[model samples]
Target: MPEHDDAKADAKATGAVTPQGSGRASKRPARSAPAFGAFVRKEPVRAPVRENTQANTPVGASTAQADGLRVETAQSWPADAVEVGAVIEAYGLKGALKIAPHAQGGKALLAARRWWLLKGREQPERHSAVRASAKVHGDSIVGQLAGLTDRDTALLLRGARVYVSRADFPAPEADEYYWVDLIGLDVANEAGVELGKVADLIDNGAQSVLRIEYPETGKDGKPTTGERLIPFVGVFVKTVDLAAKRIVVDWEADY
Candidate 1:
């Protein structure tokens, strides 16, 4: 061993080249990915949730454990979901959500059991919701969402837009129509004189008013640059046919 050491030292001292490549085993530990089921936290549901409430907690395992409850991190939003309202804030400590309705009467907001909550104006149908116990709370509506049992989670959903499928709308009463059904319907007067088309509806404290836009110039060659706010009272609006895409009113085109 001494003679071998001496020989190695002599070889190094003589500037002899050593071999580079060899059969050396690597000692590093192999890397691995986490299992899919390890993600869920077993937090107890805070409230006595309704049996119909079905929401997933983003985690995969908890979804399967919840049985009848739904679990989804992503979804393909339905095409028929009509935008109606938005979430402003969480109502109280019990996980209720406060909503700002798009329409004045909020008939479309109150009509549906399912809602699609989009984080922004972009992709809204991806994460829809199953809602319950919706009612008017001052100027806004307050409601409950499944899996949102805590106030913190509700607060996080401050700017989420609300959309409800037209398929789930409550059947309209005889002679009554939803505000969405009235939009874009052409308006004409008693003498069959075409007034204009329904541009939009404005809500006063007492009732809703229809805003009509004229096609041709009235007295001004550049069209009526005035706001035609016609009251949608029982006396003014005579007939509304969504299928026919027309509305007959007791209004005058000149006036």
Candidate 2:
């Protein structure tokens, strides 16, 4: 969710936070958080995109436009980059892009000054500096990427996923955490009974819930697996030790 100046090590932790692996972060004192905001949860919604008449264009244009919005290609990707949202389509005539931020409401995107746009998982990513960006329609964001002018170029960016370096994200308030920071941490009960690792989080309109998966021995003494859903409330989640890579809760394994 945030970072300090330990440069290289922080970069590795950024890439490791993706779904396939886990990352370790320094521990912070556990405190009672009464409310949560952008770091908590945001549901995805369809953005209202305006149609444009410009034709398709490629990302490798060499010339800079008169207004100084240059389409410069990045030579390398930032190690701290993390996917945040995707461009839906062109909005208006002056190169504005309609974006559908990920489940977290583009909190990181809103805070970032630059963005990396990827066409696909295998393709190389391109970089764009932000000229202006704002949240629109409650769940979506409309942004103007520097050097990207005209509706045609904006159309070419449709479906391009947007990424921002984790270091660029704003720090969460005490007792609050970004969902990305909680995923993959081990969860256990007060009595130290292993429950599972956090696989994902769910927003049930009222609050966030932890989705944990773990292995167990069935009544027949055979190995089995099960999922547990625990509300991420202070009453249940007692302590979160990111340095120790575990969470202590009041929940029971059977529950």
Candidate maximizing lDDT: 2
Candidate 1 structure quality by residue, lDDT tens digits, 142-226: 7776555666556545666777787876555444455666778889888999887877765554445688886555765676544
For each candidate in the order shown, give its overall lDDT on alpha carbons: 0.55, 0.64
- Judge candidate 1 at residue 4 and give its lDDT: 14
The list of candidate 2 runs beyond 4 A from truth reads 1-58, 61-75, 122-125, 217-224
Candidate 1 residue 92 C-alpha distance from true site, Å? 2.4
Per-residue lDDT for 136 in model 2? 41
What lDDT is reached at residue 240 by model 1? 79
Number of clashes found in candidate 1: 1
Model 1: how far is 144 from its true place, Å?
1.3
- Which regions of candidate 1 fall more than 4 Å away from where they truly are? 1-75, 103-107, 122-126, 218-227
The most accurate candidate by TM-score is: 2
